[model samples]
Target: MYLTPSMAKLVHEFNKLPGIGPKTAQRLAFHILKISATEARVLASAIIEVKDRITNCPICYNITEDSPCSICKDTTRDHGLICVVEQPSDIIAMEKTRVYKGDYHVLQGAISPLDGIRPDNLRINELLMRIQQEKVKEIIIATDSDVEGEATALYLERLLRTMVARVSRIAHGIPIGSNIEYTDEVTLSKALESRRIL
Candidate 1:
């Protein structure tokens, strides 16, 4: 069956999003059609507004409508400690925990040789500059536990060792409620390796 040209275009656009298959795109287009015109307009306006207004913070590269994001402007956060992450979303996740009371450095992307993403493609130079200029005392590598993340963490470790700060990797282990049977081998190994007597 042939969809109307506009509806077909909407489905195609939705399909371009990450993890959105053709079927899912079609479903989303139809769902949007079912919504009130005002609500749909609001959604479209929000998307446009974000693309139009959002800009990366100059200091940390986190996405925000302002030059320096609210986090950077906040005086209570520990500027001496920086948590390095692979993406802006990862910073959001860490902030949601409300336990990390420090600044952040968003790499924007990871170094994945398979995808031709190298160190130059990320914000590594900015991080090093920040460390040197700010006299940062601690760096927490909060990159993912995957191969790329691990490689980035190791690279940062060596780089920061020569600086005036202590560097540490975030500990990995099992989730609070996850069962041992469902846990991955890497997590199990890390948990055992970082085990504490307490």
Candidate 2:
């Protein structure tokens, strides 16, 4: 069965998304075609709304509608302690737990030489600036347990040794090769509780 030009285009666009294959994209396009026009409009509008409203928090670089974001602005949170993470999505995962009430700083991405992503490509400079500006007592390196995450953690540890009072790494409750995004709230909370000094 030959697909029309518009359907083929939609499939191609969906295929560009992470984890979406050509077959899945085609199936998704067909599903979209079967959905009501009003439903499609709602989906399209939601996508547009996110693009229009969501912007990076200037302080932590987390995705937010406001400048500094609620976490950064919340006085109830520990201002001296900051949790460092690779992506904004990891913040959502961490928040599911009862532990960890400190603020967060999103690195945006990890350092991967093979991927041509260096420390400069992340928010390391911004983090350093923040540390200098604030009385940051400690920084928890909450990058994933993968090789890239480990390398990034080591690099950050070395870089942040003298800059801050202390630096820590989240514990091994999260299995190697497993991402924090998929980790359960219990495991994530335990990991934070058992974090080791770096």
Best by TM-score: 1
lDDT (0 to 1) per candidate: 0.91, 0.93
Cα lDDT of model 2 by residue, 48-80, tens digit: 999999999999999999888999999999999
Q: Candidate 1's residue-wise lDDT over 120-172, tens digit each?
A: 88999999889878969999999998899999888888877978558998998
Q: Estimate each model's TM-score.
A: 0.95, 0.86
RMSD of each: 1.3, 5.7
| Model 1 misplaced regions, further than 4 Å | none
